[model samples]
Target: MPSLRHELLAYAVPRVRRSRELDDAERERGRLERWHSGLDRSLPTRLVRHLHQRYEVEVDRTGDFPTHVLTPRTHDVEATVVWMHGGGFVAPIDAFHVRYADRLAQQLRARVVLPDYPLAPEHTWADSHDALVEITARWTASGPTLLGGDSAGGGIAVAVAQSLRDRGHEQATGMLLLAPWVDLTTSTPSTAWFNARDPWLHLGKLKAYAEWWAGSPEDLARPEVSPALADLAGLPPALMFCGTRDLLLPGCRLLAGRAAEAGWPLRYVEEPGLIHVYPLLPAIPEAARAWRTTEGFLGRSFG
Candidate 1:
């Protein structure tokens, strides 16, 4: 059974389906590109104000990305979390991303760094992968760090970790993924089936973005683009969250199984009736519960 809040929250998102009657692909792409540019321009001001209420925010430009370091209002910051913002590889970072990073930092007594990575249509995975690899590598080198992100960012986090592992470098102490879209190809049965129930994700829109992020079919099969096809052995312990109503749930299930087979410590929590990236939305009660679970996992992992 779904929580009352979760059930009610579904109604807030418009039930806009992909149809030829609405618009064409070019129009959709233009709209998304414009929206991403606007959001990128607007997020810094809004996020700085919101994050300052809880922590000191430091903004630094690293290569092609802008990194926001959030040091919480605490004396002992035990760890560092390099959190990636999810935008389906096309959308812009939102207030929810900032809030989640701030709250998670506070909960774990850790400093959080959120990076503004390049998005699709304008930029592809190739354009942003090396920068993320460098960022995660630098942070993980200092000590044990938690690598985290939601949706496309989650996928990026995993890809970065895998690259580091392949290079014989330990990248992440632990990984926290929120409704990660591990398989960009969406080759799973549930990916298509769950589209009807998932209010936030549309298969058609997702396919378009996936193509933009991954330039070719061969690119989709690359481990850096889709972690589902990557070897997972010897990586850090992971905690993953996904909702049954999310289009990516099936891929997560496959990932859990693959991790188990590879002897990786991956704790996958599938919420029965929740939506995508529920924890990012603080208004929902499930978000609190998810945060509590994440905090507990971090505590035990650190201990």
Candidate 2:
């Protein structure tokens, strides 16, 4: 029998897809693109807010955009996790992911910094990638830097790590991805099966949004734009976490296979039954365990 969570998501996923007001696929995607822009401040925040009670929220707006730092009491701070929050490059930051950076910071006993990068339609993904690179370079300087995020951020983290390796920077220690929506191709077989099972991201919505993101195929194929299509060669070790019910399951499996082919160490945690971005729901029992598992992996892989 399917877990309650999976059943619930299965029921809820189609509702979100059918709820789209736009009559045509193209227009509906454009509407979602605009709708995602204003979510930065309002998307739920408890996962991080709860953890914040035990730690301090530090902001470094000293740069172009708002950059927040979460630090817990710990002696070792040599390693850092440069966290990029996920919202399909459509929002500044989602509340679902804000807490994750905090928890990881507290558990790893290392500094964690999150960049408030822009999302889709309003700005190009190239703009977002540049901002990511700028902040990641600074964050990794003090010590080993681990790249991580849920969903889109996870994909971004992988892209940056692959980029650094390609340049021979030797900075990326590893990457932790949670239900990462990597393959923008939208042709994977899972699209038909998990599409209805996965909530939050609709294939129809993403396809429309992705096309709007890039007017050209070449632009979309850029590693930073779509890590699923990016060459996994010479990339840092990666730990990909995806729920069995997530629509992204197949893409992650493909990423893992690429890592193997490229000779990159790959660690995957496919929770038997969960939904998209479950790691951000650390308040839940299953979410907490998922985070602890990642914490142990990060501790061993990072400095």
Candidate 3:
């Protein structure tokens, strides 16, 4: 017997998880090719198809890993934000993640690149990694680079940061993660607590994404596969926000503690009553606050 809000969140969680199972995102890769069919395709030939429909942000097609840059026409553009979309590892950059990116890009006054990184079951998903690496390498030699994303992409951001560190590049200024899927292993109390309340996502969907993205021991332990398990030392500071209602909250907590113990400034936000990547829904007041908080965190000096 959960309370009403608890019960509603609990109920909403499964619908969200089922959306993963039934929607194009959680849709099994290769099981269906493109996320949208020709008839389903839009007049605008690109990732942010409905950009015109959205009045606030300016979207441009950047041909790298099917990436897009979302910027505010009126802003100063102080920094750059690279966004990775989350769908376990099987989903594409859907509207939910896009809205978050647009809002962030506009608010932070930073040029933002949102890459629709390939999902699993594709031979090229790793190529998506290479794509990110290539792009990041270009930025590594420069000023403050902020890496952010939701779910799997957030994990990828961590991996990207780690990759830079391993290469001795030290380019990233900070990481902003939203309920990031840091652990492919998926072992945590929150995972089980939100097990029933997450509006979308479940062990089965999680397993499906994992099966497609990783196989064998090497893959499982690969730093990119689960940065939560990866050594958190020497990484830059991070602001990781997770809802108390998300299964991945534990992952966020563990990674934050690991980073802090390793002596990096890792700020973890646990919104008391929200669930997975709640910031995506900008219409929500909490989501708006999250964006403002993120801007404040990222607005400071970065050499």
Candidate 4:
């Protein structure tokens, strides 16, 4: 059963910030203007302030965009995590993303790398894919490194891992995916049913976002854009979580099914009646339990 807090968030978030408006905008001009007009790509001020007090934060400019590295001030680093922030492929990183990364660093004693990758309409997956593959390869060369993200970011993580394997580069030790939007086509038969129940995601907006990120209808099914359709063989162990209330649930299920057939080591956890990225939400019992599950997965993977 969903908690009261979860229920409240599911109700309140949609009312305050609706994506239908974005969906209804003119496809090219209006959508692009609205997306980039007042976009602030920097990390949240509150998150930066908190990181300064408790962790060592450094900015890496070696990539196409900035990647923030956070290490605990009081603990030795046990591993490294490359965490991608989720925003349906357009939104910037928010406080919740950094906060969750910080919690991972503290609890797992890991160095967390948060990449501010370029978003869509202005940039496509091609722009950032090679850079992320290089970054993951560099991290894995030193020690065990995990690739992780939620929503669109999770899809990027999977694509990066695939690229690494195909290129014969050092692969990430594991992956942690949260409600990943792996299929840009949004063609899953069950997705329409889930879309009706999802409070935050709109099917029409998701298609628009997909077209923007993919750059064309022809590229929508490309493995880099729709990783669930990619060959899952030879990838590292992965832990994935999704909720029934998310439109992305069917895509995650598709990835899991493919992983099984390809002999990929993937453990998928599906929560009934939970909202998108339920594990990342604060002040919820379900999120706490998800964190514990994450800790356990990290322990096994790092060993």
Number of the top TM-score candidate? 4
lDDT against the true structure, each candidate: 0.80, 0.69, 0.68, 0.86
Candidate 3 segments exceeding 4 Å error: 1-64, 71-76, 301-303
lDDT of 3 by residue, 1-303 (tens): 224554465566557645644344344554544542222211222445555454334333453445565545564667677877787776566766665666665555667677666556563345567667666656556555678878888998888887777777756777788889888777665667666666666666675566568754357657878888887878777888887767677778888878878887788888886877877753566766787778788776353
Per-residue lDDT, model 1, residue 124, is 84
Clashes of each: 0, 3, 9, 0
lDDT of 2 at 96: 53
Residue 17 of model 3, lDDT score:
49
| Per-residue lDDT of candidate 2, residues 240-303 (tens digit) | 7888767678888888777788777888888866777676652466666776788688778864
How much does candidate 2 score in TM-score?
A: 0.83
How would you order the candidates by TM-score, starting with the best? 4, 1, 2, 3
Best prediction by lDDT:
4
Better of 2 and 3 by TM-score: 2
lDDT of 4 by residue, 1-303 (tens): 999999998898778666453436356446666877788766674753567867777889998899888777877778888898899888888888888877766656788888898887778888888898888888888887888999999999999999999999989888999999899898889989998899899888888889878988999999889989989999999999998999899999999999999999999999999999999887889998998999899889886
lDDT agreement of model 3 with the native: 0.68
Model 1 C-alpha lDDT per residue in residues 1-303, reported as the tens digit of each score: 877887777666434323222246678889777877666444554644555666777776857877777777746678788998897887666777877776767666788888788778888899888888888888888876889899988988888888889887766888999998889888887777898888778888877788788977668867878888789888789999998988889888988999999998999999998888887764678988888899899888776
The predicted structure with the larger TM-score, 1 or 4, is 4
TM-score, per-candidate, Cα-based? 0.91, 0.83, 0.79, 0.94
